[model samples]
Target: MADFTYVSTWRGFVYVAFIIDVFAGYIVGWRVSSSMETTFVLDALEQALWARQPSGTVHHSDKGSQYVSLAYTQRLKEAGLLASTGSTGDSYDNAMAESINGLYKAEVIHRKSWKNRTEVELATLTWVDWYNNRRLLERLGHIPPAEAEKLIMLPSETMIWQPEFTDKTLSRKPGAVQTGFTRHAVSWGVCHPNIYYFHNLTPGWVSFNGEKPEIAIVPQSLHRLIYGPDKRSSPSLDDDLVVNLCTSEHLLVHHPMLEGILLSECERLKQHSLANKLISLFRQFGGTELRLKLVWLCWLDLMTGNSLDDWTKNLKHKSEKDLEQWIIARQGQSEPLTNLMDQYVLMAYRTSVDAAHS
Candidate 1:
């Protein structure tokens, strides 16, 4: 909330506008001017913007002509601030700002007589510095606003470990195929028993009805455009074609694409709520690029025909038991594999909860 009060002196009356943070009661921005122009409020707001570089901040003020003017409203919008007005003649609406105004009047204006506006301005500069950095208020636990801010902005501690679901409950079996497609399905609960539309289809998974008819995996729009007139039969249904369905469908759906398919895929994956946890984990471990890298890795894994047995062949210990042990050992470790593992674990927990409710 913000408000400006007048300082009377022998020279003239100086209007001082202040933008106060409601929560901390800190004077974030202030501007002293000779007249009460719309710029009077805008200058203070500008100062606050430069100091905080805030986004989605609310600037609440009274319905003064200065605040309601087009220039002032435009400035607020440009700075990404939400401009709010209190009801006219209602003290309670702007009580926080009013309270600060009252304190300023009592502490500065009434304390001593000033010769000119210059003296009042100078005195205000000194007083504001002391108020924000040195003044201790009972409301702030007798600590200065600067100190309170430091405490509030400090980083929080890391999360402690907690296991919410077991392997059996999540329907994850020991030594089961741990392909990229399976990981994605388990993590997101996207591969349902009924609704089997996939962003990417892999080995050993059938369509919803299991008819296995030749499916033309095209964009819904293209399907409409082609069949609306031709009434043509879908193209030959083959495993290779079915395997490419997801990526092909994505390209068809997002027609007239200007950029790479990988970017689109990455964005689409992130939109899923379950995928968010995986994205966050990647961000924490690796930098920003890791999020996109992990997505591409999943795509690459999906493209590969290699089975777990094949992958385990050249390992230091090559037995089936050795491969399973190695897989378990690497759980929650690093990128790509770690994200995939986390996804499966989460999916298992979700499945258990859904089953219980159903």
Candidate 2:
């Protein structure tokens, strides 16, 4: 929930906005502004986004003018957040926010009279750090919110995201709206539809799927568009192509043209900054499948096109056609062969994640 409270500073009344995560009772984002405006809340929301990167969370706030403004709502929609407002004119509807405001009033605002917005801002900066990392909350088993969040951090796949709409269960929180979230409890951020679709599919996997006459069109769109498809990839069929079919059912479908198309797409990605996308995929995927990820790394090498140097140092540079014959033989392997191969893929992924963060 987000709301602004006025602090009695010497110059005048300065407003401070708070965006709290109801789960841990953690203040994920906040801003101390000289005036109450939409940007006051928006900047704090952005801070929470940069910090938490949550997906499918609901943001509840009162029907204050700033919260209802177009800019605020549009920003929520852009972040894939669901927006819910408490019924108008009822202070009890946003009881959680009201309680926090009371806490703030007692803790800092009433304790000392700030000389200016600068003093309040600085104090808030110190207070927020303390609140997240140290201050104990009775609701969270008397431990600090940050510590509580650490306890709640479930595995990514098993983490249960909030429902799409508001209901009585959410209302119990009484104004637990989220403009910003803490990543400790929920970490999913929006990924591009195309990247999520194409990142896991190898050319060999696509080839095997393409051999099925009914499924051939799916591979074409996933491959380099230069090869073309009878029907292009769209939202409806992307999930069906990936999840519905069992890998064990397919014979590694081969096409003389597939290797060329995948080469073109891989090289195209490597030439542009989009090649960095594979690194983004690294954090989410458990690890590479079989040696296909290895093949992909080889494909990315401009000097040694399709050479299995890292995985098989014995064989020097290998041509695309030679690599093709080798890949055809290994598609049936159920599991990745060596732990060393997984380490290599994981090492590359970690480097990517670290570089991007730095």
Candidate 3:
């Protein structure tokens, strides 16, 4: 469903169109504009189209002129969507979109006095991120829209919020220029016990995007400690300590594990500012040799002995897309990841007790 609401700005009243998924109550697409022009609404629809690429869906909206516009109807038909408008003066037909608009107004618009379109735009971006990923909905079992989406095996859809708008951005007037690609990426190289785990067991989790050559940053956390939130300069590093990850297999396995402990400990101490040197270098492309060398390292919870930050599973995955489906199907309905690892220990205890009693 789609709807537009007016936002108060010093320049004038800006209009924001929101298109949300009814099933998960996830805001799929949104655009802030100076006017409620047909082009602005089309921009919102474009965002939704590329982000999700849904096949068989209904595009429902109120009996507004924009919704009934010829251009809008043509676009909907081209996308193979059935356009449905509510009967004249029927309020309930577009209640879902109205409900979302009401929340967007009360929560964000009413909270601040805006100066211009840019302020409202930035604020909306932040609020939408939180709303989809963090805000809980009572109807969705108190889970965020993202969690609810995963539970229902909905295809994960993410709108890349670019700092600058591309050719897709609509100006207040017609025939405005908008143009861009998502360029920012981080590569993490992990050290797993079984280097070929992705190749043999969970191949689906890996994508072969040989974008860059192997750039090793041993004790991966070092990258994050430096370039991550806490920026720190590194002293002259020892080549032997870094090369040992290749020559000395033992160091390769244990060194990253030690770093993992340090990272976890940093959070435990809550004095990250004092220990800013430790950071994570956490992005990488899937490859043949790297997969063999990559290791998964973690500090185990004393009670459970299960590797903290590690997911235990026995399965074969074919591609990155397949792994996404697997996660949605198997793990989405399970208890979410928790900061405290004691939950796994309790789970183990209960399973043993149930088995012994049976």
Candidate 4:
């Protein structure tokens, strides 16, 4: 959903409009203006349209006058986009957009002072670049939004976070980011044994998460670790075969056999600063083996129920336009967003399990 927030500057108050791609939480389009005119929202929409060239994309927003204007509606219709507005007095209806607005406020507007529209615009441009390209998001598996979209299934140079075994464990390297855990998360580029297994099995390279060319661990390996090496067709290896994190040293060490641990951890620790860091390292095992494609499905389901058909079966190849319609339908639903998100994750887990077995 799209919404504009007011920014205070020496020149006056400028409004900022943002159109976010709910899939990876990327701000696809944005505009900063001194006025809350329809043109402001329209310009943002035009930029998004031009960048994505999307057809049947849903544009959801609050019942603001600018969003409901004739000019905006006409533009959406002409571009083959659908417009959806929340009901009166319902903040949760446009919760996702509002959440973005809240983040922009906390991270940029509230933290820094602005001189004029030019300054705000420049800052926003920089922030968007950082947010999409470098910022690690827990929802997207501790990867940036752009990296999620440009996913290389078999990454040539993949970085793994080697967890410190205990507080007494000597540091092999300096920590990149402080995650407030007992053990500081360290990133390493060395080839782990799991990488070699995939390299040998698939040969050249394959999409572990179905995002071609990017190296990611498929559910089969996760199954081997979570269940047992002999549980599947793969040859039995030591306990360290997969990036097993559920040992006595980690937070989730007790819940080794947990299903949907990734999604559950998200709901459990959504507000924790160190949540993403912990999750990215821990989700490699159990039934919650995280992947970008499955996370994208959770995003779609979070936005709206039944927006995309369950890919566990026949309708696995739905188009983008159909996905957009699902978002529009979701905005109009009376059901809770959390329930929908859970349902989608469940469906994704089942589908992934089936795919791994096949």
**On residues 1-358, what C-alpha lDDT tens digit does candidate 3 reach at each position?**
7889898888989999998866567899999999888999999999999878875365777778887788887888778665656546655556667778888889999887999999999999999999999999876668998996665452212211111212221122111111010010000111111221111110000101222212122222223222333212221122111111111221112222333333333333342431232232111212111111112222212111333222222222234455445434433332332212223223212211111111
**Candidate 2 per-residue lDDT over residues 1-358, each given as its tens digit:** 6677888889998888888876667888889888787888899889888877865465767778888788888888788665666557755445566777788888777887789999999888888888788888775667898887775564322322221222333222211121122121121111112222233222212311113212211231223332333223222222333222111100011101222223333332332232233222322232223233533443333212233233334223444455445544443342332332344345333211111111
Q: Summarize candidate 1's per-residue lDDT along 7-86 as a digit string, tens digits.
A: 88888788999988654567889988888988878899888888877654556777788877888778777776656665
lDDT value, residue 246 of candidate 4: 18
Q: Write the per-residue lDDT of candidate 4 for residues 1-358, one digit (tens) a residue.
A: 5788999999899999998865556788999998888999999988888877765445667778887787887787788665666656666556667777887888888987789999999989888888878988775579897886564222422322222222221122111111111111001101112222211110011121233232112223222322333333222222222221211222322221122233323333232332343344233322332332344333333222332224333223434455445444643453443343344344333212111121
TM-score of predicted structure 4: 0.45
Per-candidate TM equals: 0.45, 0.44, 0.43, 0.45
Each model's Cα RMSD: 21.8, 18.5, 21.2, 16.2
lDDT of each: 0.49, 0.48, 0.47, 0.49
Q: What is model 4's C-alpha RMSD? A: 16.2
Pairs of residues at least 3 apart in sequence or in different chains that clash in candidate 4: 152-213, 152-214, 153-213, 153-214, 153-215, 154-213, 154-214, 154-215, 155-214, 155-215
**lDDT for model 3:** 0.47
| Clash total of candidate 4 | 10
* Pairs clashing within candidate 1: 170-348, 214-237
Of the candidates numbered 1 and 3, which has the greater TM-score value?
Answer: 1
